[model samples]
Target: MEWAPVCAEGETYANKCMADAAGAQIEYEGECENYFTKEQAQIAAKKWLEEESPTFKFDGIPGSIKYIGYESYTCFGCFGFTFTFNSSHAGYGNRSGQMLAQAIANHTILVQTRGKNVSYALTDGAFDELRQIFICPAISALIPVCGTDNITYPHPCPAMQAGVKIAYEGECQ
Candidate 1:
């Protein structure tokens, strides 16, 4: 199964003015989600893997998912282009929320159809998937997004904190 939070790579992804700083558009297909923090992105990958696995044969090969971000920065002039996954701009209504994609199907399932000038992403069922995986309460997992956990999805994955084993809260990506 594949999943990704749908996004248009244009028109100032975050709440910036209509002007896209880069004056360039970039869109993504397949499993993807943007997050301000490396921890948040890893959390999302883990969530998606857990949600998608039961439907597929995700065993010794791989189970959960995770990611480590490289360094990125931008002023308001280019923040939108660089930060497409920020909660303030993505589907989440508030900046306090994090951008996450729980897997359902691949890119084919993310969009219903391409519109005249716009394409839409289908993220309505993510909350339901989160409920299914966590089983009790989504946030109840003792794992903190930034700590060292042997339980990371897709074992032997990306190195965290500039090649250090422990991941940090900010600036990894």
Candidate 2:
């Protein structure tokens, strides 16, 4: 007789070892719910970010929000979600977590307002010229820096050369 491992959810595994590795209870065979889809998780992540923003606090500032990207994972008896985001203003970098939606939301709001709080107005034509000059090199170097104007630069040098003071050392987004 050929023996196969049956998990608690009645999912057949290649063998007992495989089932155990998956964290499936061998004795309680039944049905398992479907795993969360990427799109669904993304939506949930966005909603979580929005809902959790009210309580998010950073650097003694309130109502700040950060940008976030979501990814989904499947574990033995549960589904897992993770967020990728930047938190440099309060002083940090690309970070990930299963429960970082609030942090990301706060940081994003901070970055968005980083430029607005300051008063530095530039003409559309001048801004366009500066963008043309520095955007390409910054893109090639892969250095994302934010300017005092709240505009994100491809690199710090570009922002400096353009006479735009560097506000932060990472992408605003």
Candidate 3:
């Protein structure tokens, strides 16, 4: 997510936090004309992870870890990167079954990057904000809605929890 300030003289920042910190009035609904795409962001994140934290493991076996997904947010004035990983299909003893679910639902790998520098936060999640989705109540009625992220959520809570705006009422086409 990139931000361009409301004023013509204002500069564009990588994310919202930078814009806010710089006292730039941002047009939140729109994105800057030029910014790194999701692919670039993911690549940078993966490269940083593999190179800087080669010893990191999700569930005892580093080979079983997978890059599930990622989301970008702002921090101060520098480029901020947060990468979250999860256990793979091959599960081991304690980190398996329901226990695995609970563990993943609660923790994540947070990696931050700035220029050639990288650091680890040691705790976080890809959809930590939407963690409730994992325990959503069994619905007797289904009220699906299409989210601005172009994904269909069973109910508004899932999308809302994930910080996704409702685009329309129904599944995405």
Point to the candidate with the largest lDDT: 3
Residue 5, candidate 3: Cα error in Å is 18
Task: Give the candidate number with the greatest TM-score.
Answer: 3
How are the candidates ranked when ordered by lDDT, highest leading? 3, 2, 1
lDDT of 2: 0.40
lDDT (C-alpha, whole model) for all candidates: 0.27, 0.40, 0.49
Give me the runs in candidate 3 sitting further than 4 Å from their true place.
Answer: 1-36, 57-62, 75-107, 115-119, 123-173
Residue lDDT tens for model 1, 1-173: 22333233422244222123445343433222332243443343334333442222222123222222222223111110111111112221111233334433321112111211111222222321222221123333333333244323221113221122434442223
State the lDDT at 97 in candidate 2: 31
lDDT of model 2 at position 17: 69
Candidate 3: tens digits of C-alpha lDDT, residues 37-104: 45554566566555444223334334434566554555322244554444442322132223333243
Tell me the TM-score of each prediction against the true structure.
Answer: 0.18, 0.24, 0.29
Give model 1's TM-score versus the native structure.
Answer: 0.18
Q: Any runs in candidate 1 off by more than 4 Å, and if so which?
A: 1-17, 20-38, 55-173
Pairs clashing in candidate 2?
64-106, 65-105, 65-108, 65-109, 66-105, 66-108, 66-109
Give lDDT for model 1: 0.27
TM-score of 3: 0.29
